[model samples]
Target: MEIYIVGGAVRDRLLNLPVKDRDWVVVGATPEQMLAEGYRPVGKDFPVFLHPDTHEEYALARTERKVGKGYHGFTFHTSPEVTLEEDLARRDLTVNAIAEASDGSLIDPYDGQADLKAGMLRHVGEAFVEDPVRILRLARFAARFDFAVAPETMTLMRRMVDEGEADALVAERVWQELAKGLMESKPSRMLLVLRECGALARILPEVDALFGVPQRADYHPEIDCGDHTLRVLDYAASQGQPLTVRFAALGHDLGKARTPRDILPRHIGHEIRGIEPLSELCRRLRVPSDCRDLAHITLVHHTKVHQAFELRPATVLKLFKECDALRRPDRFRLMLDACLADARGRLHFEEAPYPQKAYLESLLAAAAQVDAGAVAAACDDKSSIPAAIDAARTDAIVNAREYWQRDN
Candidate 1:
């Protein structure tokens, strides 16, 4: 049997990137032969085995036939006669189709090396349309490598989207790709690529609707809601924020898309109006609770957080209670980070200071020092304990705000 290292390991290595995982493709090998050689079979839809020692995956050389629709529609054919070239041909991108033989010989049947050097993303073959997930994967690769998509490949992606392949993608896979893309260095590229191919409208219409929507240029400077969202997402990524924070940045301004035309560029009450669409997005994708919660809090309270200095001490204390900042400070900090990303994500405002985040943090810290347990103990009646705690926190916030103002 002939074995070769394939896919991302080869691609990343060629780019001088740190290879995280290595995938293997074994040509001229049957499942029975693989088992006899001590490789454990792990694939359900095809012949994939794991090495007994390294535990890395080794999939047999195979070809796929598109039977129905979406990613799961493909049927696999694996045989000892299957060539390494045939297996490589079934891959999504040309850059990813390169293979390295056991003896360190490189194989580039589709001219993947040329495209890799040119920093281009191009399809390997016509089989690219057989799987809809390729569209998401290509967009994600654009975000990762900052590579330009070949025009013909983009045309092919648009055709696939037009043929309803994008709609056939499953919820889990959509969320998976989107989450991965959000964590990439230039997540804005992923969104813009999906938009260019019209897959963004199919998969995330709420986000797509924001593209042409107008926003007040005095505040946004970008003048487009979609542009603002992209900036926010990229800012979150550039700050090395976690997935939850990045997700929140992406969803924070979704309500702006639903603004009434009579209001023109103003998105007043968009934060509250954003709840329905954002909730639907999270529910449809079956998004993880932490991501969903952080996004929700950022969407609903971001404007309030930005207006922190204008809010009364009691109002600030109430906001803290609603956000549960004292109990779940990490998530609260993530929400603030998302708000900070939004603040910095406008035209010529990339480095703008977000004093509100620090102000809120200071207020939260001061209120948290109020000793709720002691306040509850001192309350004369059980019914008044909640009020007593709130009063103490409000007073603490008042003092802290005055101190902060004086210091600033």
Candidate 2:
């Protein structure tokens, strides 16, 4: 049997990127042969094994045929006769279909290396339309590598959407790709690509609705809610923010889509109006609580964050309490990061200062330092203890704000 490195390992190596994991295609090998050679079987749907020494994945050479719909609707054929070229042909992108032999010889039957050198994302074959998940994967690769999608591949992706293949994708798989794309260096490209292919409306309708929705031109010179959201996502990525923060940035302005047209570009209550759609998005995707909570907080309280200097000390204290910033400082910081991204993601505002972040952070710190136990102990009546602690925290924030104003 001849083993060859394949897929991401080969793709990343050719691009001068770090190979985090390696996958192997064992040509001319059976499961029985792999087992006898000490490889541990792990794949439930196909023949995949783990190396006894390196523990890296080693999948047997196999080919797939589309049977029904979505990603799971596939039949796999694996045998000792399956060639490495056959296995490579099943990959989604031409750049990912190339393989390398044990002797360092390059195999490029589909001209994947040429496409990679041209920074192009082209499909491997007509079989690319069989799997709906490839649409998301291609969009993600566009974001990750900043590569241009080939016209033919994009036309095929659009055809997939028109033919309802894109709609057949499962929610979990959609979220998986979305989360990975959000953490890329320029996630807006992913969203734009999906929109171009009509998959955004199918998978993320709330976000898609923002594309043509108008925003106040004076505040958002971009004048498009969807465009603003993409800018916020890119800004979050530029800050090296984590997945939660980036997700929050993506969902932060969803409410603007529901704005009343008579109001024109003004969305007076969009902050509160956004909660329903954001919650729906999180629930539908089965998003994790941490990401859901941060997105919720950013959507609901971002206006407060932007108007931090205008709010009263008591209101600021309430903001801290509502966000539970004392108990979860890291999430609070992420919330601030999301708000900062939103504030500066508009046209001509990329470098705008967001003093509100530091102000609120200082206020939270001061409020957290207030000794609740001491205040409760000093209260005259037992029923007044909670009120006394609240007053003390507010007073601490007041003092912190005064100090900030004085220093400035």
Candidate 3:
């Protein structure tokens, strides 16, 4: 059996990127041959094995034919006689179709190297239209590599959307790709590409609806709610925030999309209105509780967070309670980061100072320092203990706000 390093390892090596995982394609190898060689068979639908020594994935050289619909409707054929060129030809992208031989020679049957050098994402062949997931994958790769999709490849993707291939994608798979894309260095590009091909409306209608929605020009000079969302997501990434924070940034403005036309640029209660769409999006995608909770908190209270200095101490304390900030300080920090990203994402406001973050931090710290047990001990009646603790926390918040004002 002859084996060659293929897919991401070869592609990343050509681009001078750090290769994180290496996949091998085995030619002239059958399942029996792999089993005799101590390789562990693991693939459910195809012949994929784990190397006995390295334990890395080694899939048999195979060709796929579309037999049905969606991403799962492919029939795979693996045999000792399946040529490496044929295997590469079935790949989704030209840049990922290159293989590396044992002697370190490059195989360029599809000219993957040329496309890689030109910073292009092109499909291997017309068979790319068979799988709907390829559309999401291409968009994700665009976000990750910041590579431009070739016009023909984009045309094929648009055709796939038009043919309702994108609609066949299940919510779990769509969210899987979207979560990966959101973590990329330039996640906005993924959404932009999906929007270009009309897949965003099919996969994430809540987010897609924001594109033509308007916001006040004075506060959001970006004007478009969707553009503001993308910018906020990018800003969150720039701040090195985690996935939960980034997800919150993306969903923060979903309510604006449902704003009344008469309201036009002013979405007075959009923050509260956003909760429904955000919740719907999360529920439909089966999003994890951590991400869903933070996104919901940000959606419901982000404006209150931005307007912190104007709020009463009791109101600020209530904000902390509403977000469960005292119990989950780390998540509270993430909320603050997302809010700062939103404030800075607007036009001509990229570098604007976010004193709200420091102000809230101080308020949280002060409120957390209130000795609840001491307040309980000082209370005359058992029923008054809860009220006493709230009063002390509110008082602490008032003092902290004054300190923040003095320090600034």
For each candidate, what TM-score against the reference? Answer: 0.99, 0.98, 0.98
Q: After superposition, how far is residue 189 of candidate 1 from its true place, in Å?
A: 0.4
Score residue 351 of candidate 3 by CA lDDT: 100
268-351: candidate 3 lDDT, tens digit per residue: 888888889998999888999999999999989999999988999999989999989988988998999999999999989999
Taken over the whole model, the C-alpha lDDT of each candidate is 0.94, 0.94, 0.92
Local accuracy of candidate 2 as per-residue lDDT tens digits, 5-98: 9888999999999999888999999999999999999999999999999999999999999999998999999999999899999999989888
Q: Candidate 2 deviates by what RMSD? A: 0.9
| Candidate 1 lDDT (Cα, 0 to 1) | 0.94
- Give per-residue CA lDDT, model 1, range 1-408, as digits (tens): 999999999999999999999999999999999999999999999989999899999999999999999878989999999999999999999999999998888998999999999999999999999999999999999999999999999999999999999999999999999999999999999999999999999999989999989888789889999999999999999999999999899899889888889997998999998999999999999999999999998999999999999999889987898899989887898899999999999999999888998899999999888888888888789999998899999999999999999999
**Local error of candidate 2 at 251, Å?**
0.3
On a 0 to 1 TM-score scale, where does candidate 3 land against the true structure?
A: 0.98
The 10 consecutive residues of candidate 2 with the worst lDDT sum are: 313-322
Residue 339, model 1: lDDT of 93
